[model samples]
Target: MDKLHAQRAPGRPKQNEQNIPLQEIILRQAAFLFMENGYEPVTLQQIAKICKVTKASIYYYFENKAELFTASVVFMIQLAHQSTLRYLEEKDDLRTRLEQIAKAKMMHAHVDMETMLREANPHLSEEQFGRIRKAEIDIHISLAKHFQFAMDQGSLRSGDAMFLAHAFSALVMLGSRKHVIEHNTPQEDLPQTVVDLFWDGIATQPQHRK
Candidate 1:
């Protein structure tokens, strides 16, 4: 049978492979608008105007606001996964591994999340919010497994997985604070200090527990 004559999968559109470029362009612009302005305030008509397409064209890809928001979140997660996986695979030592994880997470969070969250907060329904919360939790849980692996490899001290996961994530999210002239700390020095504290200690090495 001819490929075109073959039945399409149920509920799935016969998407053109090359058209993905256009889809991504539209989604990227839409995601940015949503992140900056928010889903509740932005309509498909607005997105179309920004993307320079008619409302009819926007409807060809996404059905509604909810679907578009969900797709944007999924896209962000996918990009994060790709970046983390690539960096994590390259590091050799456990300390290096942890450092890479922290740096990668921090870089991504700083560059990406604030706007994403600002928009997502009001636009999402209760169920959507809960689901997103769980998805983020699961991402942390998966990261925790890597920390546990480091411990098993005798790189990090043995400890609670969930606690460590939450701790590491929080540290990255909170970042580090330091004074400039008063403290003489350079801007570049702060993140390295964060990495050191996770492995070393706030106090001297002699006083710290393994």
Candidate 2:
């Protein structure tokens, strides 16, 4: 019995053909669960269950639920950054690209990021907090770069690219609010409406604006 236990560790992670690390698989599933439910409500056991791994197997990769939650949120943020880049790269027209990004973002019901982070706050360390913030900023910077390019080309009025990016993000976040969304406006039109509102304000003949 001792020899058998030594040969096969109890916490050995499951393997896959793609060679993706068990850590990544765990992070992916954990991110989904954390995003679906808040950090406080999700447990390492639940994450392990979702990933089809034993709780001890998760412990091999993460120290505790807090560490797992931090990693999961960072993973989710990086994935969002990648998805945003793909959408932005799909079109050249600023309005069209913005609309595409908005539509993709609004397609799902968002767990309010601010609220989620607030819930996770006590569990995260400063380094963990920094990681999440950097990942979130990566998406903003990508959008800002695109906005800067359009501004440089005289396609958009001269203004702060980063601010525009933030404004656009805020406008899209409104789509996630139930009361605002429930107000007569059709769900399908929300993305277009958001883009229109953002564009109309900035798309005025390329004049230098403070």
Candidates' TM-scores? 0.68, 0.83
- Residue range with the least summed lDDT across 10 consecutive positions in model 1: 176-185
Candidate 1, position 58, lDDT: 60
What is the Cα-based TM-score of model 1?
A: 0.68
Q: Which residue pairs show collisions in model 1?
A: none
Off by over 4 Å in 1: 1-21, 36-43, 105-119, 176-187, 206-210
- Candidate models: Cα lDDT each: 0.63, 0.81
**Tens-digit lDDT string for candidate 1 (72-147):** 6666556666665665567576567667766665543322344456666676677766655665676677767787
lDDT of 2 by residue, 1-210 (tens): 455335555656767678888889999988878777778888888888887878878877777788888888888778778889998888567798888888877765557778889999987899888889999888889999999999999998899999999999988888656524475657877788888888886565657759
Best by lDDT: 2
Candidate 2: worst 10 consecutive residues by lDDT? Answer: 1-10
Candidate 2 Cα lDDT to native: 0.81
